[model samples]
Target: MAAPDKAQQLEEAAKAAEHAAQTAEAAAANASGNAEAATAAAEHARMIADQLAVIASASPISDFVFLLTIFMLAIFVGYYVVWSVTPALHTPLMAVTNAISSVVIVGALIALGADLSQSANSFAPKLFGFLAVALASVNIFGGFLVTQRMLAMYKKKER
Candidate 1:
């Protein structure tokens, strides 16, 4: 209303604004402190989680599952090696390899099979089937003979 009264009102308003700024600064400091505490707590929780993961990963069940997976993978790799590595298997290597794979699979099946034509609990059929196939494969392919000849040549040279 009056100029002097308006000046007094403006001075009071500035003091109130300074007070508000101080309160806001305090609140901001408290918030930053709480955020730091929260960050520390989260870091602690993450450390616990990492320790638990290490323990769980090294536990017996996890180890067993990991080893079993590796073994299966190794068997698959062996199958791949056998299929591709043997030069003597020339024309029908794939077919022969398939036959070999089938025989081995039959043995595995026999190992897991509900026995048939023998003891109800027996794995004889699967075992016998795989054995017969293996023997026949050796006879037909002469792989053993070739290996033996190579061994004999090596021995002769060594002698």
Candidate 2:
């Protein structure tokens, strides 16, 4: 076979190099496009996850309203039941009520005594505690006086 000419061999080598460079550029562009698409997909997934987290952490207003409704209903029921008591039994009932209120006074005293150092700085809780104690004390004394008056009325008259 005849030896290939030097000029022809050089021309073929140049064409092969150009072809390789073109193939490499096309592959790089395809890889860049794939990377961009993957990045967009990851960002979308992250956004969805963040939205789900916010939904999970949020409290519903309707639930709070339902609890408030139940509490108000209980208060109304208690008021009606107390008002239905007979006058003759009122004194005894008041005594029992005063006894229950004593527990409230104790709780209030505890709240007032806790963290004495902070009492001077934060006054609202202490003030409420003081009010609770005063009100409970009044109820206890008033209940005892009413009971004494009712028992006196039932005393037998001397001949």
Candidate 3:
């Protein structure tokens, strides 16, 4: 009876390990499928981005003028919004502004670095990138200074 019980236990253990192995394989397959789908999505996004770049380069002068107009409008809107914020909210606003300025800096850097090897039509983007970098730098530094000043106002005066 003892011998028969030990054999049964060994068979049960082997079956459990087999089931575990199958479950692991299924999980690995699922992960592989997810990875492949992600790769395909990334590739599609890259293709779309490439198409947009080409379109931007080939776009008409009116398109450029329209974009410039939008940029100008944005500046006006930002000015009004910033000026309207109350003193109590100014520091938080400045922090948000700094975060946005950081994003602008990153975009400017990407614009500067993009297609460095393309000799044709590269100068225009590079010039714009340089301007963007300069403007973002000023915005970021200025925001920091203003935030510092605002924060200072909150501190208790030392005896």
Candidate 4:
């Protein structure tokens, strides 16, 4: 058999190399495109998860209102104790103040229990309302005791 020409061998070798390089380039492009798409999809999923977390962590407006109310009760109790400690205040004022404080507590309990049974439009408002009211009652009762003690101390001083 005649020896293959050197020129033909060289040409064949060049063609094979070109074909391999082209295939490699195409494969690399495909891999890079898939990676880019995967990265984008992952970022999108992470963003959605963050949004859901924010929504889950957000508190309702009613809950905020209830929390504010509890804070107010604490302040009220503090104010009452301060007032009861002063000796210049009269007996009638002390007695009326204590009675009024107790009455308001009963009113709060009634409002709270009512709220539990009746929501804005539904049959049940929320059970938390009752708990809030009960806690408020405790604050008022505690304030009254403090006030009574202060009054007793003042009366002993007067004698």
The best candidate by lDDT is: 3
The runs of at least 3 residues in candidate 2 whose Cα sits more than 4 Å from the true structure, single-residue gaps closed, are 1-71, 116-121
State the displacement of the C-alpha of residue 115, model 2, in Å, after optimal TM-score superposition.
0.8
Candidate 3 residue spans exceeding 4 A from truth: 1-61
Cα error, residue 59 of model 2, in Å, equals 5.4
User: For residues 26-82, could you state the per-residue lDDT of candidate 2 as single tens digits?
Assistant: 766765665566566556555655565465558554656645654565565556545
The lDDT values for all models are 0.60, 0.73, 0.78, 0.60
Tens-place lDDT per residue, model 1, 1-159, is: 699999999999999999999988876676566556656655655565566557668776576665565566556554554444334333344455546655665665555554465577466666676676666566545744555555565464544
Question: lDDT tens digits, residues 18-100, model 3?
Answer: 99999888766765665566566556555655665576678764666656655665565556555554455668878998999
Worst 10 residues of 4 by lDDT: 81-90
Identify the candidate with maximal TM-score.
3
Candidate 3 overall Cα lDDT vs. reference?
0.78
Tell me how far the alpha carbon of residue 3 in candidate 3 is from the true structure, in angstroms, after superposition.
Answer: 91
Give per-residue lDDT, candidate 1, residue 4.
94
Candidate ranking under lDDT, highest first, comes to: 3, 2, 1, 4
RMSD of model 3 against the true structure: 17.3
Worst 10 residues of 1 by lDDT: 83-92
Q: Residue-wise lDDT of candidate 4 within 38-123, one digit each (tens)?
A: 56655655565566546556845465665565456546554554444323434444566656667766765665556343345544
Candidate 4 accuracy as TM-score: 0.35
